[model samples]
Target chain A: MSRTQRSLQLAAYADGEVAQAQRAAIEQELAKSPVALREVEDIRAQRAALHRVFIEASPTAELSERIQARIREDRQRASGRTWRIGLASAFAAAAVIMMSVRLIGPELWHQELVSPPPLVARALAVDAVLGAHRVCSTLSDGTAHDEFRVGQKSIVEANRILKALRAMPKEGAALPDLSESKYALSSACACALVSNCEVVHATYNSADGVTLSVWMSDRPLALSGASKLRRVSGEGGRVYQVAEVAGGYSIVQWDERLASVVLCGEMPADQLLKIADRIQPFGSAARPTVGPRVAIVEMALLRRS
Target chain B: MSGKSFEEIALPHLDVLYRYARRLTPDAHAAEDLVQDTYLKAYKAFGKFELREFGVRPWLLKILHNTFLNGEAKKKHAAHSTEPQVLDTARAAAEIGSVEGDLRIDLDGLDDEVKRALEQLSPDFRSILLLWASMELSYQEIAEILSVPIGTVMSRLHRARQQMMTLLADYKFRGRGEPPNGREAT
Candidate 1:
């Protein structure tokens, strides 16, 4: 390597960032020239010292989660529609239940019998829109996913999309322990619970120093005090939730706002309160005592069988 | 794209994102959380993600970088105590199991003078060095994360090394500030 290249390489060499061939060439220079060798070695020392000095610093996990949540929330707002929300909700339901139930998800049955879940519905709409974009991006490149209709340039290439999705590898995460309930969607409230809970699961682990967890959803519908749900509003907006029921557990309810989201779990009221505090612009609190959790709990319980 | 479900797409990048965050933040708690944020952002934008030839790793990294920089830059304007001083803890014998007061680098036989020289560079410089060292990326990819130009990336790396060499040659080791055992020339 020339002297200039060797000098350019010093930082990368200290970092061990260079490729094998490049590294070998640099090493060859070090052997041939004492100055080159001394210079490279000096950079390496600084690199090591810096690592030892700053080994413990990193970004807070909360910021990362918030960013992701912000993106998710933005996308949701962009495709604003009840049907879309419903499908997206259904998907949120399925993903949560898939964690709490059998690997062979029963949401498929729900997909057929019940209207497709909310998250799924939303994605389908987006799939249609993005599918159009995909086709456009494709057609712009001169290759059509399918033979174009003689006059219809606006139509999506549905078959290709379906094929790609089917061929895609699964989206993975740290799944919750689901040995309990079949799916969180057996009841309408369960759907709400899953969405809120999964957001917690997705979000809690990543905040700085503040430990966040999405409590396990136990099956067999064994927990007591589930029937006493109370609806409350927080900084986000009006929250429909259950409170102070069986198991000393309160139902935290609220929307996934741009800056606020309500939570419901078996965790301490203090911790949940702290979560609420961290998320701002919460809506006013409401105590609309929804009908006994009996129907909802019964629905969830029966589905466990 | 459309056909692929959530698990198929987002999970694979978690570990790498975590490792990157860990290095950047240097604090275990902060790194864990930063990694999670990277995932959530990835998940939400999964629909918008297209299969560009450059790949998702870069995209995710770009997001992570933006998120981190946003928070970090905001904090920079916030007031803080005086900068961290050079803490002289007895090179914790258990850490590298040294003899008397010597520093032993188990990863390699490289000596202590080299180790301190590294610590002198700023975090940003160190990050650039690591990105270059990791070899998992090309110059364009590193530029994307660091938000620098291909040419600037080239120049910054050059300057970073020059700084390191100058810093190392001037450093004083222990009390004497001379090479250990007075062996300046190997």
Candidate 2:
């Protein structure tokens, strides 16, 4: 056998990886050649050295706790989704009953069924926003969704929506320039979450592929009965409501006069708030930076709004 | 076996996963993130994992390998860089043959030197060496984790050892008995 071939075989033998039949032949050869035997010894020594060096290298003490915490968070989100699904099924049955009554009763009853209770309407709006974000962000066939237009397309669409909102008689929130924040506008879609109300959904993607979606509406969403939402004061004494969504994602919503905005992403509430602070409305004055304590309080105060 | 939770079966391999992740990534933070991503993905797919003779370690490693590769592919696409080069086995074997000597490698007091040698290798070589030397996974298991043929694993392992030996030989001859960077040997 060639010298290199023999060397490799010695390595395998030293590793105890050689087949049974080849092992005896390698042993017989090793007995004849001192050089080959020494090579095997060297391989064994290298492996031992590797073990010694790497055994001293370990992840941080908190790594285990961090992973465990994440798993717990995921499980909680899953259970919450299950509860929401059950509630949604109940709502679906109620809707079917209302539809039957509307069809059999007067025209006024048809109008009442058409315009749902404000709380239920807001819940439906929230569901629609979440659905749009999922459909736009969900990757298909190992590629990003085609509808998630980026670059000039996203920027132009965002500007058009901003202009349309600005032309309206009431003041509206401007789409924040996320360039300084290291996130680019990936897509913007004008979706009608409520009848006659157009909500602009703008998605931003960071360099590391973290997606943040911002939904802007000209009218205030009736968020009073949304479950698990916490209200917190941001920089300009603005009351921002935050909540955890189905996938451990955070949603931060605040009302601007004639404009209501909701920011949603997989980021923690504090990070999302920081992104929110950068999103200045058209005529609002600059506000002082909030502390991490506010974020802690906001997280602690999670309740049905 | 039937009633074991995902954590019961998979959490025991966290250290192994983290060590391998450290070898794959450049920093401690990135390694932690990689391990976290691996665990999350594994937990999601745990329902589909069937217990094999080699147990959950290999399955977790396969997920880690795929996760790392996907991240690497994204990074490459963003940077518009060429694919990483695969080791040329014949040329590596020739080079290994040229380094002819009975120079003793002092395994003692060479931790830093060994780490530096490992760091200097290409990712492919480092991966193969760590799987074989550090994790001590068998050739078939290594092949399974890497999704490569067993013959490819053997050849690549030979190349990895050859490269490691070459780097260690340089350190040995240059540093003599002292450790690299004048640091006291552990």
**Against the true structure, candidate 2 has what lDDT?**
0.66
- On TM-score, the candidate that comes out on top is 2
**Model 2 segments beyond 4 Å from truth?**
A79-305, B83-104, B176-186
- In candidate 1, stretches whose alpha carbon ends up further than 4 angstroms from where it belongs are A1-6, A9-34, A37-305, B80-120, B164-176, B179-186
Query: Which CAPRI category fits model 2?
Result: incorrect
Q: Give each candidate's fraction of reference contacts reproduced.
A: 0.09, 0.36
Error of 1 at A156 (Å): 25
Q: Please give the lDDT score at residue B64 for candidate 1.
A: 69
Could you give the DockQ of candidate 1?
Answer: 0.08
Which residue pairs collide, candidate 2?
Answer: none
The window of 10 residues in a row where model 2 chain A has the poorest summed lDDT is: A139-148
Q: Residue A141 in candidate 1 has what lDDT?
A: 17
The two-chain DockQ for each candidate, comma-separated, is 0.08, 0.16
lDDT of 2 by residue, B1-186 (tens): 589888888888988899988877878899999999888877766655689888899888877776676565445434433222222334555675675444456577778888888888766677888888888799899988777788888878877776786677678766666533322222
